[model samples]
Every structure is written in C-alpha cells, then in structure tokens.
Target: MDPFKQMGDWKKNMDQFFGDNFWDEFEGIIKPNIPQINLYQTEHELFCVLNIPGLHDLEKIDIYADMATLELRGVIDLEFGGGQVIKEEILQGAFERQISLPFPVRSDKITATYRNGLVYIRLHRLISETSNKRRVNVRLLEDE
Candidate 1:
C-alpha cells in the first residue's frame, strides 16, 4: 500500500547486509546536507545558526541573502597528518546550501558572523509600503 514502506524495508535489508555504518561511509561521496542549520524567526527578524567546525579562515565562507532566499558556500578541511583513520564521522568538504526564507527579507539588512565553530546570521524582514502589495504600471508598446 505504502511505497515508502517498501523503501524502508529495502534500506533495512541493505543496512543488515553491509553493516550499520555502510551508508555513513558514503556520506562524503553522497554529500548529504553538510553543515546542519537551525533557523528561527520573529515578528521582524530571522536568525539562522549553522554547525560548521574546523574553520581556520573566515574568508572561505560566503553568505548571501536575497528577498526570499539565503545561501551559504564554504569549505571545511581538516588534516590529520599521514595516518590511518579508524572511524570518521565529521563531514569535511566544499558545500553550498540554499534555504528559502519564511517571508521576504531586506537584502541590505543582513549580517553574519562566525564564532565557536558556529555561523550565526541575522536578517531583517522587509517591511515597506509595497512589501505586501504594489501597483504595477502597464505601458503599451508600439511596433517600430
């Protein structure tokens, strides 16, 4: 009846066949939503926090905000010196993530900062006379 239920059953079978961490081992290749994020909003503002560790240079990260979208691009590189890895879990690679905002935001009124391995972004909601509704003037075009 449920197609997703069969998919879940297949996943369980695969996990049993390959081991519990089979999928996790391919995360770097699969590139699964790296640098997890949390978003919160208020009446006039939006706050977003991203979990990204091992950042040495801040210039590697770029944050962009538009009327209805927020995008982040960055790279996380951690070197462990020429050694064998027993178990790896942390994600480290170049990543780009775009998120849709709940409402329109002022592109010029956004600020972002990184502290303690967390990236914090603050955005102000666009509140203007034309924010909700605006009149568009139509002009007739004449063929040359």
Candidate 2:
C-alpha cells in the first residue's frame, strides 16, 4: 500500500465533493488581495501611486509619514445583490500597506491627494547634497 496512492485517492474525492468554485467562494469570503502600489523617486522627492478604485469617502483614508516610512490605511466597501453568487473576484474590507522610503524625508512636509480612483503621495527630501565637509590643514613653525 503506497502512501502517495492513498493521498491521491483522498484528493480526488475531496475535489469532487467541493468542486472548483468552492475555493473561489471561500477566498471571496475569507481574505482579499492587497491594493497595488507604484513607487518612484526623484532628485528632491519621493512618490507613491496606488490603485484604489471604488473608494468614495476621503475621510476613511489615513496617511502617516515618518523619516523612513509611509503607511496608508483605509477600507473599501463592496455591496453585492442578495442572490446565488455565480462569480466574485473583487475584494472589500480594511487594507493597510507600509512602504519604506528610499531616503530620509520631511514627515511634516508630506502631502497626499486622491483623484481618478488613485491616491498620490509626495514626500519631500530632508537635505540636498549641495555642501560637503572640507578637511582643514594645520601648519607648524619654529617659535620666534
């Protein structure tokens, strides 16, 4: 009696009993995927663009910035009709994502805005490389 053969038999029975749509329904009710995000940086700033469709109330969104990180928290509500669910792929509920900033940023100077179902965040850099430290030389002379 092979263990693999027994496991395969059990797997076929489980698949036939649950069917393919069972897992889809289970996922739809259990966990939702995280929102997609796009990040980029410039010489003096950092930007994060997130694709967050179906968000209506701006007050539900929260943005927090720090020297090396940014966090976005919000919830998306999705309502469906009361009937037999044929197919469902969209996710609805609370979502939070943390992003690590490329360099130190001005937390107080960060700004965010939402438009066309997307959220745009701008983070200003803390310092520019305009000046650098210079080494000083010392000279010794015979006492006179």
Candidate 3:
C-alpha cells in the first residue's frame, strides 16, 4: 500500500466529515462571547453590567430594551496600529447579544451609562395588572 495514497484518503475523509468550511465553524465555537454581562434584580428594578473595553465611540453602540428582553449591538475596535500579532486573545468585533429579563421591564424607563470600560444599564420593572390580584365588583341581575 502506498503511503501517499493513504494520506490523501485520510485528508478526503476529514474534509468530508467536517465540510469545506470547517475552520470557520470551528472558529465560531472557539471564539469567546463578546461583552460578558452580569445581571442583577431587585423588587422593582433590574441592573445589567457589561464588560466592554476599547469603546471609543459611543455612537457605535445601540441598546434596546422591551418588556422582557434587552439587546446590545456594538463594535469594539482595538486596532491601535498595524503590526504582526504575536498572540491574539482579546476579542474585537461587532457583536449583538440579547438577554432575557427575569421579569417584565419598562422599555421607556431604561437608562444606560458607560464608565471604566464597563456599561451599566438600569431597567425599571413593569408592574402588569395581570400579575396583581384585583377585586371585581359583583352586580345582581334584575328578573322580569
């Protein structure tokens, strides 16, 4: 049996098993999730803290909040100068992350602030009437 023929067969089998875009798919799994977040909740409010370094332009970031979700979309560009990278570990790219709130939140009452390479978000809880018990008035019907 020829060793060159065996090597070619092994390569073909790997390509078939992983597909042509195996590196791209593997990179996606290996890359860390950007802007790591931590969430806290109180009786009437929710707080979120995100670790997002190298955010020069605030305009590049967009934050959206609905009743039960919070979405963050932004770009983290850390390209200081063009040079050969020895070892790359920091994640710098465009990212979108959606988080589910513990409870309903008021979208109109959300506030966000950025400081010390961290983004802080404050969300007020939406008190829905359905979640609270209400006493309904009872009326007697008149018979003819």
Would you list the C-alpha lDDT of every candidate in the order shown?
A: 0.85, 0.77, 0.84
lDDT of 1 by residue, 25-113 (tens): 66646546877899999999999999889888999898888788998899877856678754556877888879999999998788888
Clash pairs (backbone) in predicted model 2: none
RMSD each, Å: 9.1, 9.7, 7.4
> How far does residue 53 in candidate 1 sit from its true spot (Å)?
0.8
TM-score of each: 0.68, 0.61, 0.69
Scanning candidate 2 in windows of ten residues, the lowest lDDT window is: 25-34
lDDT per residue for candidate 3 within 21-93, as digits (tens), equals 7755655455667778899999999999998898878888999997798989998888677887545567788
Point out where model 1 deviates above 4 Å.
Answer: 1-31, 131-144
Best by lDDT: 1
Superposition error at 42 for model 2 (Å): 0.9
Q: Assess the local accuracy of residue 50 in candidate 1 as a C-alpha lDDT between 0 and 100.
A: 91
The positional error of residue 97 in candidate 2, measured at the CA in angstroms, is 1.8
